[model samples]
Structure formats: C-alpha cells, structure tokens
Target: MLPDQSITEELPKDRKQKRQPHSAYLRRRLMTLTSIIIVSMFALEAAVTAWYDYRAQLANLEKEAYLLADAQRSVLAAAVWNFDFDIINNAVNNLFSMPEIMQVAIRYPDGEVIASAGKLSDGAAQMRITRPLLWDQGGEKEIGTLNVVIDISQVESSMLVKLTERSVTLSATLFICLAAIYLACRWMTQPLEELTAAITRLADGDLEQRIPHTQRNDEIGNVARALVKFSENSRLLYDLQNSLTFNVAEKTRQLKQVREDSAHDNTVRARLLAMVSQEIRSPMTAIQGAVMLCKNGLTGEIQEKTLHMLHVAERNCERMQKLIEVLFDIYQIQNHSLVLTLSPVNLLKLARTQTEIWRNKAYQTSKNLHFESGVAEAWVRGDEKRLQQIIDILLSNAVRHSGKGGEISVHLRREGALISLSVSDNGPGIPKKIRPYLFEGLARSDEACSDSLGSGFSLTLAKGLVELQGGQIYFESIAKEISSNSTLPTGATFYLELPYIPAPEAAD
Candidate 1:
C-alpha cells in the first residue's frame, strides 16, 4: 500500500505507453525535479532518524551501565566489608557477561583492584561509571567502589543497521514517487504534444489533418474545438481565393484574345483604306490638273462662275489628297514597316521652315503664327521628313484649336543633350472629357474634332514616330473650363524633344 512497499513491483504493460519526444523530454524534466525534492527529504529524514536512534542507543547503554553499578554496589560493599574476594569476582564476571558492559571492576578507595571481569578493548570507546561502597550499617564509612565501563562500539554497530534500514526504505519511496511523477508528466504532456503538432500541420496548410481528442470535456478539448473552427474558416477562405484566382485568369485570357482580334481587324482595315486611297488619288490628281488649266485660260476663256467652281474643286482635291496620305502613313506605322532616313538635320532651320508654311495655313484660318528660337543652330539625328511631319501635325493642331485671332507660337531650343521644338496656341485648352483618351487620337466629339484633316490616330502616330527616332513627346494643357492664372499661355504646349547631335558629330 505504501510507496516503499510497491517500489519493486513492475508496471503493467498496458500502462507503459510509448511517449512522444516532446512528452519524454518534459517527463524527464519533471522526474529530475521530483527526484531532487524527494531525495532531499529522504536524506533529511534519514539523518534525523539516525541521530535520534544513535543518541537513544548510546543513552540506554549508559543508563544500563549506571544501573548495573548501582545494583552491584550493595553486594560489593558487603563483600568488601566482610573481606570476601570470591563474591566480588563472581559479581564482576556476571556484569561482564552482558553485551553493553565491556569491563567491570571492584576496587578499594586506594586504587587497588579487588576484581575485574574484562581488560580495556583495543579501539572501542568506553563510558566508566563508578559507584562507591559505603558501610552505612556501621558509620557510613567508604570501603570499595564498583566501576562499570560501557562499550559504545556496540551502540555504533546497532545504529549502522538501523540507519541502513531507514535509508533503504526512504530511497525506495523517493524512487517510486519520482516514477509516478514521470508517468503523470508523460501522460499529461502527450495530448499537449499532439495538439502542438496539429497546430503546426494547420499552419503549414494541411487543413485535412484531423485534430485528435476533441470529444473530451477539458482545456485541450476547448482548444481543439477552436482549432476546428479556425480550420473551417481557413478552408472556406482558401476555396474562395482559388475561385477568385481562376476567374481572374480566365478573364485576363478572354481580354487578351479580344485584343488580338481587334488588332487584326485594325490591320486589315488600314490595308483596305490604303488600297482605296491609292485608287482614288490618280483620278483626283488628274481632275485638279485639268481644272487648273481651264481656270488659267490655257484651254479657253472662262466665266467668273466657272473660275470660282474650279477654285472650289482644287481645294476639295487637296483635302482628299491630304486625308489619303495620312491614312497610308498610319498603315505603314501600324505594320512597323515605316522607313526612316536618318541624317543630321539642323533642327532650328527645320522648325523655322515648318513654322513659315503653317503660318500661311494659320492665316487662312485667321490664327496668328509666331516663331522663336533659343539656339542659333540645333542639330539632331533623325528622319528629316518625319521630323518635319511631326512639327506640321503640332502646328496644324494648334491652328485648328485656336480661336480666331488666337496667337500660335513655335519655339525651338536646346535642352541639355537634346533639341526640343515646342508649339503652343493661345486658344482654349484641351477639353476634359477627352483628356483620358487624348493621345489615343479618337477626338470623341465634334468640338475636339473641329478640323478633320487628320486620321483619328494623329497623336498616336506622332508618339510612335518620335519613339522610333529615339525622341520623346509630351504635352501640357489646361481644359477650357479652368482659367489660366500663370502668365505663360492658356492653350496647349506640345514638346517634341530629340537627342541633340553635336556639331562635330554632324560634320563627321
């Protein structure tokens, strides 16, 4: 029933469950702590018990020696009084026969020995108790003394045996208590270790691994139920995320396909328009020539009415030719087959020339054209024709957007390692509704498309051409609704910057 009694009993095979590494480590710590505490208590108790037992054994032996001396004092006194040596020797021998009495002696008061049963031992300690013989029957006169020496060596041997027994019992109890603590720690930590592993699995996205021991009504069970809820939520979120990703990928694929189809359709339409324009151009050119000849009286004299009609025909023919040229240019650019003849061109001269040409055109539209140059000669390497065309587009756009009598300015300047030609107009700034799609070149409204001289892709084509020549183009514009507080201008300023070619490189 006690721990010491059951210490040697073997544990049942079923109760000895295999411990997990975590549980085993925890159990080892618990066992070590329990061992320290229990062993300390055992040591203290054993020391106290041994100390008391040793003292009691020594005291009992000493008490018995004194009592033996007292018992023999009367007889020794009578023997001494009668001068009987035989009785004295017999009593001394009797006292020595007992184990505690190592030696017994009867002696006269002058230290002469009458009788003694034993000599002193070689190493055994002795307690000598002396009792004097008094002949009180006569006049209480002293005759002889009895000396009993107790052998404490016997008490030491007895203490050794008793201490050994106590130590054995306590050691057994300490071991069993430690073993029980170890088992308890292992049992309790097993479920905790399982829960820890389950948490790791869940964190690693192993949502399918079932958490064990959920049915128990304990703290571990509460945690298990909470984990179960978290797992369900995680699974639901994972499913939703997967579904959302699938839908996004599918939508992106559909968008890419649609864009490919649209690009194909645009390519085909550009080719068709180029073909139709080429067909219409020859006849239109011939008609313009014939009308010019008749109006000049080379064929015959013409009335004023016929002359005005011929003038109208010439203007319409020019408009048609310009539209066709724009369409063909758009097609060539779209197919990436547009050829550029690279050369070192004087950018300032080019800007001046284009400004003059557009100045005449702007005059016809009642818009004033102004030109300014910040550098004497700005050189850039590019297709001279394409550069001229880009300037023409910007100038034409300025003229078209400008109100009557609105001032248009063409500025040419050197911008560190580049040459920039900017054209601006003092007209209403770009409209807000088309700002988002402004560069895509869909004018979007009649107000934005006031001049239909260009294809819907004029800005787009200009941007592509600038990039092809290693240049950049950007613009700044305030919509018509906002008033310009700055002194610069109210309309748009489009900048076309090309890599500047040094004069030395140009010469080479």
Candidate 2:
C-alpha cells in the first residue's frame, strides 16, 4: 500500500497514551495563577495586620504606665513625707505585684535609696516612669521619688496569641477561596475539554464524534460549533478520498490490461513479419540466381537494350532481397531471438576490410571513401558476421547520404579498454525532424533523397546488432556547408565502441 494510504492505521499504544490532552495544560495554568494570587493576598493581609497590632499594643502599654503612676503618686508622697519606711516599702512592693511591672524603687530627696523590689536582670523587659511626692496638695515641695518599671514579656505573649489566631483564619480563608476558584475554572473550561476530546477522536479517524456544548453562547461554544463543522467536513473529505482511491485503482487495472494487449499485438506483428520474410526470400534468391546467369550470357548473347533492362531487373531483385533480409533481422531483434556466434577477431583489420569493399563501390560514383587506423591491430570478442553487418549498414548510410563528390571517412583506434570504429560523412546532416527517432525502425527524414532506395531500417539494425554484441553505437552531427550554392549546415559522424581484448602472442 502507498504511504499515504496507511494513515488510518492504529497508532502505537504508547503514543496514544503519551499524548497530553489540552484540558490538562489549561487546568495547570489556571491552578498556578490562582495559587500565586491567593498566596500573595494572604501574605499582604498578614503583614498589614501584624504592623497595625504592634503599633496599637505599644500605645496601650504607654497609656497604662502613665495611669498607674498617676493613681499611686499621692499614696507614695504621703508615705515618704511621714518618714515611714514600712509605708514606702509597702507602696513599692504593691506596684511590683502587677504582672507588667518588672521592678519598683523609692528614693529620698538626698539621693539615698529608700526602697527597691523585683528582679532587675540584664535581659529583663522594663518600661520606666518616675513620679515625685509633694508635701502639700499644691505640689510645690518635692520630698521623694517613686520609680516603676513595666515588663513587656506579657504584652509580647498576648500579641503572639492574637497573630496566631489571625494566621489560622487567613489560612482557612485561603483554602476555601482556592477551592472555589478551582471549581469555577473547571466549570468554565468543561466545554473546552469536551472540544479537545472530540478533536482527538477526529484525528484518530472517528469522524462521528460531536461536541456536546455547541448550543451554549460562549467562546467555548463557538469552538464546539467549529469542531462540529470540522467533523462534518472531515467526513465529506474521507468519502471523497475513498471515491478517488477506488477510481484510481480501477483506472490502474484498466491501464494494466491495455499494456498487456499492446504487448500481445506487438508479438503477433513480429511473428507475421518473420514468416512473410522467410516465404519471400526463398523465391527472390532463386530469381536473383537466374537473372545473374542470363546477364552473364550462359544461354546466348543479349542485345544492348535488353542487357541494360536485365541489369536493372537484377539490381531491383537484389534490393528486394536485402530488404527482406533486413525485415527478418528486425523481427528477430524485436522477439529477443537474435543470437551471436562470438569469436576473437581483430577489430581494426575488420574495419579496414569493410572500408576497402565500400571504397571500391564509392569510386564507381564521384565520392571519396577514406579509411584510417591508428593502431597496428585491435582485437575484441564479437560475432564477425554481425560486426560486418553493422559496418556495412553504417558505410551504406554514409555513402547514400554523401551524394556524388562528397567525402566519407572511416577511422579505427584503441581508446582505454575499448576499440572505437567511427564513420563520418560530409553530407547534408540528418534532418532535425527525424534525428530523435533515427534509430527507430522505419524512421525517415522529411527530405529523403528521391534517387536513393534507402529504407530507415539500416541504423536501427546496426544499433541492435552492436548492443547484442555488448557494444555501443552513437552519432554526432555538425552543421556545415555541403555545397557552394547552399551554405546550409550538414555533416554527421557515427561511433561504435566494443570491449578490447588482446590477441594471443605468436609462438617464439
């Protein structure tokens, strides 16, 4: 199956499980933001409350210290003025009875310490206030001094208890607020969760899934509606895709059938051509032999006009015989039945021999056929008859295309591990219109020479024969002047290459 066609297959079990849903991410973000806000609000409230309580407690403590001094001043002054040591001592002891009082002291006017009570340590908390005793109610005369010291430990303990209680309350409120916010967020995002699930199902190829909250008027509802539309569109697309797949498959089967029919037709055509060539060749060979005998005057001397006529008939017969042979060879190649009798042969000598035979023919006309070999000898493994046929085809093409007074050249040389035989002609080059299909059977140029009895079978036969012998054949054409009157470009060179093999050394 095609890669695209396998998309609907089940994904790996681990992959499906590993994918985190969209709702999970949204919930995580919402919880994190809500937690920060709740924590910040609690921290701010606790700080503000602690500051306010601290200031209030300090103010109340200062007021209580002043009030205690004011209430006890008359008692302390009278005791000190009467010179009663017990009364002064009792007054100091009474002041120290209060939990906030850390110490108390009474001093005489002469700077002598009259009384002192309570522990005075290095780390003891103390709030001090001094009041002077007056001799009369006018307070004009100073007699003695009363000093009271208040401890701040008890106040600190009270403030700590209050802060603890407020902290507990704030914690409970934070918990309740967070719970409410989480519930509200979950409720608001429930539609989104449903939409995400529907989309997942759609991706998994379940196009029937529908979002449940599409009727509600919210952003999530709009998304749900869009998801529903998407599911519908997906279903339509899947149907169209299936239809296209079925049509493509049907067309592919039809194409395969057409290809099979064409192959069978080609086979039948090749077989028919082979049978016809075999039938025609036998009688044509006999006719050629009889015509040769008559032309040689085996029976009697012939008239001049009759002899020319006989010669014409003989040549036509030979041409027909050659055509038949070419048709048979083509049929054999198309059927993959052309077998070569391979042997070690000198390629350079072979090329030279074929060139000489064609050179004599070229002399009969006003054409020049030149043969050049760069090496003393070049050897290869090939079928001699088949190789000769290829050379003949190439030379014939060069001669026919060159016309009279034209030049044709054949060259042989060793190139790397291969032997190359090249035939070139300075004629009107192969026409552009027919060059593409030059080696295709029966391909002829638009301006084929009227006097030439050339069929397009020669090059195709040559190419097939060369390839069958493990060789390659190709050609190059250059635009050049063929004549003075017409400067139109024309020239072509055909190349044949075969694997080189060294000939056995002569015995010493």
Candidate 3:
C-alpha cells in the first residue's frame, strides 16, 4: 500500500444517513417537557382547589346549623317560661316542617320527656343537643336538662346538593380548558412538522428547500432562522465541493498530459545525468591520478598551492554526491513512493547526533547551538531515514533563521507515550500574511534564502513525512514585545511530537 493512502482517502457521501432535523427534535422534546410541567401544575392546583372548597362547605354547614339551633333556642325558652306545653309542641312541629329541619324533639327537666316532632324517614338520622336549666328543690338549686334534636342529614343533603352543582359546572369548564390545550399543542406542532419535512427534503439533495416565514418572534422564529442557515450552508458546501472536484478532475487531465511529456523529459534528463557524471567523473579521476603521480614526483615537485587546489576539488565532488543523495530522497518522498523500513528509534540519541553535526555549522556562523533533553531515551517506531530527514530540516531551518551570534535551542522532552522535539531560534518571526501557508511548497522568508539555499520544499516535505509516520508538526511565533529575546523582532518555534515505542531486544 502507498504510504499516504490513509491520509488522502475521502469519506463516502450518503444523504440517507443524515440525522433527524433539530427543529423536529426540539419541538418534540419541548412539547413533552411542556406537557410534564403543565400536568404537574394542574395536578397541584386541583388538589388545593378540592381542599379549599371542601373546607368552605364544612364551614357553611356549621354556620347554617348554628343559625337553626339559635332560632330553636328562643322558641323553647318562651314555651318554658310561659308553662305552655302545647305551644312548645306546636313550635317544634313548625320547625320540623321546614325542609332543611328534618327532625325536632324536646325534653323537660328531671329527664321527663316533653314533646317530639318528625321521624327518621329516607335513611336520615336525628342529631341530638342539650340546654341547661335551674330549678329550686328544697334548699339547693337543682340541675335539669332541656334536650333538642336536629337532623344532621338535613344539613348534609342541602350542602351536598350545592356542592354537586358547582362540581358539575367546574368539570365542564376543566374539560373545555384541556381540549383547548390539546388543540393548541397540535396547531404549534404543525409548523415543526413542516420544518422537519423541508429539512428532510434538503438532506435528500433538495437545496432549494425553505421554511415558511412567520411574524411571530418566539422560539419558532429562532428555529426558522437556524433551518434557513443550515440549508444555505449545505447548498454552499455542496457547490464548493463540486467546484473542488471539477478543478481536481481538470488538474488530473492536465497532469496526465504532463506525465506523457515528462516521460520523454525523463529520458533526456537520464542521458544528461549520465553524460554529466561521465564528464565530471573522468576529469575528477584523472586529476586524482595526476595528483598521486605529482606527489610521487613522476613529473616534478608540485607547488603547495597546486596540491591544495586538487584537494579542494575532490572535497567538492564528495559534497556534490551527498547532495545528490538528499535530492533523490526528497523526490521519492514527494511522489509517495518511499517505503519506510520502520523500527524502534531512540529519539534522544537522534537529536543528540543531529545537534552535534549542526553545532559545528552554527559555530562557523557565530551562532550557538544548544541541545537539552529531559529524558535519557525516547523511542519511536518509524523510518530512520525519514526521521533523520525531519530532524535535519528543522535544524537547518533554525540555523538559517538564527541571527549571527544568536542562539538556536533544540529541546527533547518525553510526555507520556510521546516525545516532543522542539527547535526554536532567536530570529525574526514569520509574517502574518505568510504564516497561514508557511509549510506549503516554494514558500520562504527572504532573509533566510539570501545565502546558499535549497528549493523551498523541505518544510512541506518534512511535514508530510512526519504525518505519514503518525506524528504532527505545529509552529508558534511570538511578537518582539512579548518575547524575551532582544536580538529578534519575533521568533518562531516548531514542534514535532511523535508517538514512542520500546526498542526490540538484541538476539540472545
């Protein structure tokens, strides 16, 4: 499999897989929540209403009973004072005739029965009462009782009739309110249903869908606005994706044409490389032979300056070969053809080695190169070549950006299962306009590229390679006022954090 296949894979588009509309979900959830609240409120109100009405009925009954008792008291007192038994019986009969006064009775002092009226008819029972009277007997005042009977059923029936009528009316009123509530819920839910249907259509590739507008500025209005935004965003994203796909397809066609042209170009380039290698190698070999012969004094004693010139040429040739190797590796990495023979690598050691190699170069430029580690060993499973390439790229960037006599700091720290390698330089930071695309190909700061420079593909290629090996790269550049370094107006820091793996044991 290609090294970058996983990174570039596009997820499939399935409209049917969309979630239910937020408005519908919101409406349903709101409706349920409202129902729960309303029911709870009404239930509490009903319990209180029932208790208050019952207490009022009891109070009314007690008041009416007291009034009846008082009226009966006067009649009995008049009859006793006049000593007219017939008049008392007649008054008692008259009181029982009243529909609410179901029964009446009276008793004289010394427990003798005086008079009685009415009967326990229709399952009604009589309620009993008493009054105290004083009578002289011998030398002491004696106690006697005047008994009265009132029908409790009479009071109960009257109060119950009134309460029943009120309850019937109240039940009808409650039913009407509940019916209205249900209808209002249905009417409100209609708009939500309409919004849901429109959104469903939109999800099914109907970008032209829209919700009906309302003058009401409630939650419904908010929902309408959100749905409209969602539809517009979906349409815009759909159009943008199509535009991108079309551009990609067109570029692919052009690339195919370029590939055909590049085939012939590659043949020419190969021939040119072979010829150049031969031309360069032939001279270089001849010069080496001549130098050996001259050292041996085959022709004559060579001057010190001439011998030194030959040595410089040989050194340049060796440097050119190493540069060619780097170029080939970069090409393979760009084409996504480089296969990594991944193994556990100790990152601390890698950083130490790269720091040592670049320290000399930094010294040559009158800059300080510093390497510090918070860990003795940090291991990762990755391609050694690619990892080395990343370290070199970061170090080279730091070295190039660091001012003369400035400092470049390379720090490695282990955080859990990952290792963090950060390279920071005391140099002018990236510009705001360029920071967004800083890692893209062929992008460079003017100051750093003034001296000997390579193609501006290293950072981009390094980022891609690190990501391919399950690592990430990020950068931060602080402003001059905020930064402690006075030599730089601003400075940039790059971080590469890679997952760590333990090293394999040597064969026993």
Candidate 4:
C-alpha cells in the first residue's frame, strides 16, 4: 500500500530534533509546570503579604507613639501645672513599657528637659512626635511640651519573622501538591504509554496486541474501547487499503485515457467545423450577390412582392454568411490559432461606427438605437477589426433580444487605464434557464420578448475576441417576476472593458 506521503512534511521541524519519549515527556512536563505554577503563586502571595505587613508595622509604630503620648498627656499637664516634678517624671517614665515608644520626654518650651526616659543610642533610626501640653480644667493654656520617639528599625525584622512562617507553611503545601501531581501524571501516562505501544504495534502489523484501561470510565477508557474495535477491524482495513490502492491506480489510468479521447474528439470537431464553414461560405456569398442584383433590377424587372421576398432572402443569406464566418473563427479559437493584430485603435470611434450600422438593422425591427460616449478618442491596443466584430456582436444581440419598440443603447467611456463599452436593451431580460450557460457556447433565446430568433455562438465568439485583446466581458439582467409587484427594470446589459493605451500622437 502507498503511504500517506504528506504526513512527513506536515510534521513540525522542531519535532525533527532529538526528542524525549511521549510518555515520559508528558509526565515530566505536566508535573514540572504544575510545580512551577504552584511555587510562583505561593511566592507572589508571600511577597505581597510581607509588603503589606511591613507597611502595617511602620504605620502601627507611628500610631502607637501618638496614642501613648495622648494617653499620658493630661497627667503630665496637671503635674506641670502643680509644679510637681516627681509625678511628671513618673508619667514620662511609664511610656517606656510600650515597646514602640522607645524614648519619651517632657520638656519646657525653652528646650529644657523637665523629665525624660529611655536613653537614645547615637545614630539610631527612630520616629519622633512632639505636642504642646495644654491644661484641660479651664481655657486652654500651654504649660509645657511632650516628645516621644519610636523605634522603626525593628519593623523589618518583625515582617521577616511573619514571611518566614508563611514560607514554611507554603513550602509544605507545595510539596504535597507537587507529590500529588507527580503521582497523578504517572498514573495517567502509564496507561497512555501502553496505548501508544499498542498503536505502534498495531501500525507494525501486530493485530492481536491487548488494548489497556478499557474497564475504567474516562477518555483513556474511550480510547481503549475504540482501539479494541479497531483491532477487530484491523484485517478488514488492511484488505480495504489494498483494494483502494488498486482502485486508485485503475481510476487514474482510466482518467488519463478519457482525457486523451476528449482531446482527440476536440481536434476532430474543430477540423470538421473549419471544413464545413469553408464549404458553405462560397455558395452563401453567391446567393447574397444574386439576390442583390435581382433586387436592383439587373436580373430583369422583378415584381414588388418578389422584390420584398428577395430582400428577405438576401438578409437570410447575409446572416448565413455571418454564421459561417463565426464558425470558422470558433474553429480557429478552439485550435488555439486565433492570432490578434495589435495596434492603437480608438474604441469610441469603433463603437460609434458599429452603432450606426446596427441602428439601421434596429429600425427594420421597430427598435431605436443610440450611441453615447464622453470622450472623442478612447484608445486601446487591440485588433481594430476584431474589436469591431465584438461591438457588432454586442449590438446585434441587443437588437435581437429587445422587444419591438424597445430602446437599444451603445455606451463607451474611458476610465483611467481602461476603456469600457456597454450595450443595453430595455427588453424582457435574458432567460433564466439559459443564463448559467450564457457564455459557454450555448444557444440563447429570450422567449418572453417574442420579437427575436437566436442561433449560433454570438456571445461565445464575443467573449473569445474580447479576452484575446486583453479585455473582460460580463453581463447583468433581472427577469420580471410574474407574481410580484416591483419597479425593477427587466432588461439586460452587456459590458466589455479593455486596457486603455495612450493615443498614438500622445505616445509620439
């Protein structure tokens, strides 16, 4: 059997490097990642807790200093008022019992210390607060001032103890989590490793190997169940693969033979069309000339009725000649020999001239034709004769498909590096059934219009000619619905665009 060759290319280049076994990698990767994430989260929490705790300790130091100073200020104020030095000294000395208040002193406003406690070491980091002592028994009067200093250096050490306790607790929790995850990964990967070995053995034509973990209800069990069924169908798949390989080879051979036959048929058909068109053109031209001479009274005097019949015959003969030429062109295109004669041609002029020619034909069918363009010269590099032929096909198709008294219009314009020509008709639009194959070498008719007959590959020829000149052609139409009331225009418009070229004189 042929391998699925694309699988090798579709694998990642990184996968081509030396790699660990899937089972071990799965276990190790899962456990390691889980361990890292748990550790990182715990560490982040510890750091944030330590930061807030440190800030809180410093804030408590400041708040306690103020609180303790406020608590004893009244007693100190009375002591100072009564000129009792011993009571003031005792009140200031009691503040040293609070750990945060490292130093406390009562001083007179003149900077003389009345009483103080807690000696300060030189260059010790501390926070100090000062407040004036006021008498509360009467209107406020400053007797003295109280100052307190708080030790802030020990805040870091206190926070460190808190963070250390949290770290120890988190470390124990993390160890337990990592151990659980490791055990779980081992349990998961063991069965997976067995399944991997089963698949590898199955791939190596060991159809009878056991599939593990089917009794447990999990994805692993589901995989084992599926593998159990796959093992039973292993021989069937092998047989089918051999049959499919044979079928694919047979179908490829048949397809190649069919394409060869189609190419041969196309060649034969093109040659027949060329031979038939050449055979019909000579007699068609003679008949048209004879009809013309008889109508002009050169083949003896003809009656008025005979003259009208001759005109009809002459028109039919002209149409036939056109069909022959169209066939020959189709043959040339099919045989890939439709060579284009490139030159700078004025598209506007060609459209106007063809419109004038088609106007006479339109008038015969009670249809009016109009030509409009803004530019005097719309230049494009193309075969003028082929371009004219494209215009003729578009105009003729418009006139034929339009109802009697319907308006036909030929519009041309130059639009920056491209020239556009459109032929429009206010008739019952192109038929729905044939729209899909409109430009696919199919005969077309607007049966609703009831004023025209359709034959030949006019649209297909127009498409071929337009594309050969480096142009695009398309059409738009909407058929009026029988049951709906709408103001939609039931008409068809054909548009052709060719790459515009600078005028000959402008180029010079």
TM-score of each: 0.67, 0.69, 0.41, 0.55
Over the full model, what C-alpha lDDT does candidate 2 score relative to the true structure?
0.80
In candidate 3, what are the lDDT values of residues 1-508, reduced to their tens digit? 2323322331112112433235644575576567656766765666566657656765654466556656766656666656778877776776666564555656565566667776656666555555554443454332334444555664466556656665676567667666866777787778878878887887788878657643334556556666665666676778889999999999999999999999878666545544554556656567667656765668887788877876776666554554444445455555567688888888888889999999999999999999999987888888887899899989988888878888899999988888999999878766666677877655677776654244355676788789889999989986444555555457889999999787678889
Instruction: Write down the lDDT of every candidate, Cα atoms only.
Output: 0.80, 0.80, 0.70, 0.81
Give lDDT tens digits, candidate 1, residues 39-83. 888789788988898898788877877777778788888888898
- Pairs clashing within candidate 2: 480-489, 480-490
Off by over 4 Å in 2: 1-39, 51-157, 206-218, 232-236, 292-304, 373-379, 413-418, 446-454, 478-486, 500-508
Least accurate stretch of 10 residues (summed lDDT) in model 1? 6-15
Clashes per candidate, residues 3 or more apart or on different chains: 0, 2, 0, 0
> Model 4's lDDT to the true fold?
0.81
- lDDT of candidate model 3 versus the reference: 0.70
Q: Could you give candidate 4's per-residue lDDT for residues 26-48 as a string of tens digits?
A: 46666678787978897898989
Q: Which candidate is the best by TM-score?
A: 2
> Would you list the rank order by TM-score, best first?
2, 1, 4, 3
Query: How good is model 1 by TM-score?
Result: 0.67
Error of 3 at 186 (Å): 30
Worst 10 residues of 2 by lDDT: 5-14
